[model samples]
Target: MRTLPSTGPRYEPPRPGSNGASPFLPPLPSSRTPIDPPDPIEPVEPIEVEPPPEPERRKLRVVDVQDRASLGGAALAGLSLTWVLYSRILPTEGTLGFIVCWWLSFTAFYLLLTGLRRGRVVLADRFAVLLAHSGAALVGIALATVIGYTLIRGAPALMHWNFFSQDLRTAGPLEPLSTGGALHALAGTLIQITMAIAVTLPLGVLCAVYLTEVGGRASRLVRSVVEAMTALPSIVAGLFAYVVLLISFGMRLSGFVAAMAISVMMLPIIARSSEVVLRLVPSGLREASLALGATQWRTVWSVVLPTARPGLATALVLGTARGIGETSPVLLTAGYTTYLNLNPFSGPMTSLPLFTFKMSQSPENNYISRAFGAAALLLVLVLLLFAFSRWLAGRGRSGAR
Candidate 1:
């Protein structure tokens, strides 16, 4: 390439709207440039966001058990119960299999529950609970149905006037089984139970009141004694009554002696139950009563006792149930007689339980049937008493309210 001259004039291109003129359009003022002024800068704003609330933790529910486990437990429990029932009825020698089945069923249920709860929500857990509950309900219903059926089957012998009116002296298997009633046994049971209640109720309530209210330094000793009393065997109580009342006083077996024995059995149960109920009474109510210028006794009677009446009644009913069912003590204390005896102190009296015992031993099938009927009747009486106690308690509660 040839070298160019160093001092030559160079040509230049025209700028946009130079000299206030445009090549394609009208020209603008020379002071103003063709390029627009830089646009005003705007401040940048930061983005806003909120973190989500923490996820709630799932709670365990009763229904979370695995299906296999639940079924197994139910099966085991059923098998065990059946084995026990069969053993009771047949006096079987091989109890091991029954026991094993029972335990296995229970274990299976537990396993099922554990297996079902993997990575589940609270609602899902309830399925296992419902299953268990339903199983229990079904078992209870089945047992009740069987008992009711048996009781009904045996009740015909109990319906006749003679069943209530005639003594065992007049009753023979050959004699119309429907002719005799359990009136004498009924009377004896009533008398014995009434006497037992009379003896136990005041003593038990007082002991409980003392334990809950007045007992301080000696409370532990009292509690220990009460607990010991609770464990006292019925036969032991019967023997005690026999020794104390019958042997000591040269008294023959009678309703009174049986009543004393039953009272001894009932006292501890009543005391323990009453104490629990009394303790459950609201402290605020007691304080309020005291603040209102009521004495401690007044406060207890007016506020505490009234509030705990329902539980107290329940205790009484339970005590009566226990007392009425006691056969050993009654057998030891009250000599059974076929004839009706109204005098609790003088003659041997027959109670429903004693009558049932005696009747069961009879060689005749009729007597056995009568025994079952008597048992059913006894159960019904207990239920009635329970209902009555509940009704009374409810009424008292409503009145308080």
Candidate 2:
């Protein structure tokens, strides 16, 4: 207690006040200097984010065209070409120039349209491409038009009965040119074609069957040889027939010899066509047939053949068309006749093609007309054959299913 001398002020616990104040509290102190609230916190300025600069607007490209200049050039070119074509300055010159002009003009217009549609600057290069295509189309149209015009112009001469019913021997230029009918030629053609079909159909079908169904190394070699034969010239076939039948056998030139020659010509065509058609028959059919205990031959006969009958018929008709229209072989082997001859072996016979060729060679204009008529007839006949074949093929295909 000696040193406790002035220990600081004594502490005392505070007591609660009557107004719900805490008991442990100090009395309010008075100060001479005013107490200020702590300085107010500084406010942050809002961020001055300038909006992104307005996006630059994209500029649109403008197409500049010298319309008047292009059109004027085009018009001048067209007019010049027209003049040249119509004036006929040279042989077929007008036709050629007109064709060229039409193509150029069409091309120009096409390019102009394209450029306008695409909003592209019309340049000469674009026009050049258009012009090229136009030129090709014009050339094609010109050729077709010329041919049609020529054929139509020649039609009047072909309308007379004398054109189809007369032979050249009885016809003279001044005498209305009527003498013999095409009946003889028609008969010869039918006989030769019939014989050709008879020989070619069996041989061709067999060859096709062997190649497709029974083919082996030997069959491949045979097919190769046949393919090579297909390219042989009609003149060569004619010469061969002439030498073999007329000279070697001391046989008269007749429809029979012509038929044999034509058969040679038709064989490869028929064989190739038939082979392709037969091979196209699905292998599943053959397999199913065999699985049913059918022999290979039976499967081919009953299943394969029936399925491909249409194609086979088409091949035969095509072969007939090929043989019936032949002139060279028939000319060399059969020899032409004015009167009808039913016998294939005894005398010279004329076919439609041979008749046309002979008629066209005569000096009389009537003969020329007759040649045209014969040509038209022959064309019609072949077309009918094709139509019939197609019909048969359709029926066969439907029936097979």
Considering every candidate listed, which one attains the maximal TM-score? 2
- With a 3 Å backbone cut-off (N, CA, C), the pairs that clash in candidate 2 are 15-23, 16-23, 85-94, 165-180, 165-181, 166-180, 167-180
lDDT of 1 by residue, 196-300 (tens): 999999999998899987889999899889988999999999999999999998999899999999999999989998898899887889899999999999998
Measured on C-alpha atoms, candidate 1 has an lDDT of 0.80
Regions of model 1 farther than 4 Å from truth: 1-138, 389-401
True-vs-predicted CA distance for residue 155, candidate 1, Å: 1.6
lDDT of 2 by residue, 1-401 (tens): 12232334444434335336555675345353444445444455455566778899875643336544555556676666656664555445556667666556645665565566554544565666556765798799897776564456446545556555554456454455345556678778989899988999999999999999998889979899999999988878989989999999999989899999998888999999999999999999899999999999999999999889888998898778778887898889999877778899998988989988987898877667666667666776877888998898878777765
Counted clashes in each candidate structure: 25, 7
TM-score of 1: 0.66
Q: Estimate each model's TM-score.
A: 0.66, 0.69
